[model samples]
Target: MKSRGLLSVLTFSEKRENLLFLLLNEPKTIAEIKGYLNVSTPEIFPRIKEMETKNLIYKENKYYALTPIGKVVAKFFQPLVNTLHVIEENEEFWKEHNIEAIPQCFLERIDELGNCRFIENRLEEMYEPHTEFFENISKSELVMGVAPVFNPAYPAFFLQLALHKVHVSLILTKNVFEKVKNEYRDDLQRFLECNNTSLYVLDDISLAFVVTDIFLSLSLFYKNGIFDAQRDLISFDESALKWGEELFNYYKEHSKEIKSL
Candidate 1:
């Protein structure tokens, strides 16, 4: 098979793809592979033989391992698979929302959010605080957020967290900043006075997200430019948390810090 044919060898069969990823972690004998994959010998043997012919895997004593070429393929293939899974898992959310709010660099690493799950608010619950989001952040030692739109309850809620000694950081859009400064002036002042809190303001953005020591909560605007208050992507994975933090820093670098107001 030509090198181009190798792509089919890896993707055409789910069993073959699973076997490749199973072996990526460590070499495994045919019996171990069969048990781990829950496939019988008749089903798995042909895959091993085909992979052997493709020079993607080789047998040594009782073990089957990836060849040098196979390792290179797996290194790049895994990320693509993970990225697809992340988007496909929430196809409507990705399609309906303003994904352009995410910077290109971070969009390239969308696989990092593969472990996330959606938290949807019912229409009747739209005005209520996300109980899970608030509870999780309240327990976090550090919290960071980007707010493109204002939520009336957030000023006091986040201020309470800052007062409780949680290290809080926020990037607000110009309009949101003005709302906080004008309506929640006292809370904004005290939040800024806290040694543990920092605030920055930037021009309008099209998304909102909160990343904390324990979790990440991301929300986006609809294609019609309305903020989707009902759906959020939340993740507790370490990689997702790191991805969210880098996203916060990206906007933070572009925002101006508001020390007093």
Candidate 2:
């Protein structure tokens, strides 16, 4: 019956049960607990009061610690918890996936084993480097962008910028828009509407480019689909940004000039 009740408590939990287990490690005063949990007295006292009411803990020298009941519960939970950790050992699924933003607090307490291998593999994947291109993008405070190919790699930089809330403006060419406009319009629109994003579309665009506050990038398209990495690419520093910005402004200001063709 006692073990069944313990299992019941574990099953009933909608969130972290680690705190209950941690409490059994030592007798601690209410103030000490509030401090360690980084929670306020008001938020914690009620739960402590409830645990005491259930006789799960008792006070000694004004320090409330887990009772024998709580200790037994914690011990019974250990094996079930450890069995839930087999997923951490898998290394394959993570290679093709990204889970960079999951926080530590969420990761530590997970005890389920079924998806453990996939998750472990997913967590081990590393960032792929684009060398100079990534370096320039990372250093920029302002990035003016256009993406013709919708590279999955491109979204990675945007996610990084999102963490810092950096400002970015994107002007995509007509050809790129038409190709993706029907299929990915909603997702692309939301990304453009997200915080710090400003987007524009330019029709009849003959070229593709991205300019950072300090650098400029240019790429050309081919009719035969023979686009190679070395073909028509250029990178320049501050001087290029200034020139590119001026060219962008001229094109933006004279939208009517290129509207027909």
RMSD of each: 1.3, 19.1
- Which pairs of residues have clashing backbones in candidate 2? 87-116, 87-117, 94-121, 94-122
Deviation from native of the Cα of residue 123 in model 2, angstroms: 28
Model 2 error, position 111 (Å): 62
Encode model 1's per-residue lDDT on 187-241: one tens digit a residue. Answer: 9999999999999999978899999999999999998999999999999989999
User: Tens digits of per-residue lDDT for model 2 on 6-49?
Assistant: 45555565222554665868887778887778778777776666
Candidate 2 yields a Cα-based lDDT of 0.54
Please estimate how well model 1 matches the true structure, expressed as its whole-model Cα lDDT.
0.91
TM-score of candidate 1 to 2 decimals: 0.96
lDDT, candidate 1, at 32? 95
Instruction: State TM-scores per candidate.
Output: 0.96, 0.40
